[model samples]
Target: MPSHGAWLKVGGAMARVIHVFRHPDRFVSGTVGEPGERTFYLQASSESKQVSVTLEKQQLTVLSERLTSLLEEVASRFDTEVPPSAPEELTDTDPLDVPVEEEFRVGTMGLGWDAESSSVVIELLAITEGEVDENIVLDDTEEGPDAVRVFLSPAHARAFAERAERVINAGRKPCPLCDEPLDPEGHICPRQNGFLRDNPFTEG
Candidate 1:
């Protein structure tokens, strides 16, 4: 467990500090604001600590897809049991226990498998001073920006992948004519020469 003071600070030249959560009770990806104006978040929590970080939709999508692919590869290569799918009730919801606030926006992310622990490691990095708050804490002995590190069991990783897939797909329906997402007020499809279609995506 990180000291309370350590949790309070995260800044510096751009160093990578690994804060590992071995088995978080809740690890989730969520969004705030409307679709176009949305802010994405990836949060993880144990009984004693919680961390939230800002991320982009593109990042979330890539993470989810990569996780799924990794799991498949691991299962096949090792002949291990496939990670179970997330429960249906849990797939389409945000499992945030605390209110959403960003610790820092993710600049770059890394992922790897820990063969010894049989867990997936996720590293959230703040690559530059500009990506971190100057007020964030840094030890006198420490240098560079801080990174948020998390480890997830295969089941939890699978759950996150499922939840992320649902969230990404829960946006506006696509217009068949132009393949552009339709707005609530409707979209003027370019393929239709800017014609306003109330329902261009009818079921076949």
Candidate 2:
């Protein structure tokens, strides 16, 4: 068991839980507090990208031991291993085009409490409506094969909504009515009222 002193303060914020985790990076597993405030840190020599778990004083004594064992189990499934700082073999490959990302539906919603900041973040919205605060909102819709609906964290979701006013300013000129690339010269869009389709895409 960890000692009572293992628990530490994160910041000045008197968050109810103790702290909160934000900007959930690709390199860390997310965790939050249950009842009391807790600290978080990286386990040395661990193969995980980064893991955030509560650090209570009581768990301090056995923290490394318990974490190591648990990390091993997780390592088997993901990339977790202790190896040389630099790999024996490394290579340089040609520049590949941008990777295409397929659209995926968020079938479920997840909630994680941040013990550091004492705030909560919501993820993966599936239900049309959840018993959450009015300050939070999530709405997703399936438009078509070429378009998708995205719900943001409200802090930064306004930059790219697929509304008419937004589309005009966005430089995303592909007509929704016509897959045909919008050309000011005159497009085949029925909505264009016979506007000419002028495309800069030239072929050799």
TM for every model, in the order presented, reads 0.69, 0.18
Error of 1 at 39 (Å): 0.5
lDDT, candidates in the order shown: 0.69, 0.27
How would you encode candidate 1's per-residue C-alpha lDDT over 22-69 as one tens digit per residue? Answer: 667678887777655777788878787787888878898899999899
| Pairs of residues at least 3 apart in sequence or in different chains that clash in candidate 1 | 9-137, 13-144, 14-144, 14-145, 15-144, 15-145
Q: Taking the tens digit of each residue's C-alpha lDDT, what string does model 2 give over 55-161?
A: 33333323223433433343355443422221322211212112312122223333333233332333332223445332232221121111111212212111111
Residue runs of model 2 more than 4 Å from their true location after superposition: 1-15, 21-58, 80-204
Q: Determine the C-alpha RMSD for candidate 1 after optimal superposition of all C-alphas.
A: 7.4
Per-model C-alpha RMSD: 7.4, 21.9
User: Which run of 10 residues does model 1 get worst, by summed lDDT?
Assistant: 1-10
User: In terms of TM-score, which candidate is strongest?
Assistant: 1
In candidate 1, which residue ranges exceed 4 Å CA deviation? 1-17, 87-92, 127-144, 174-204
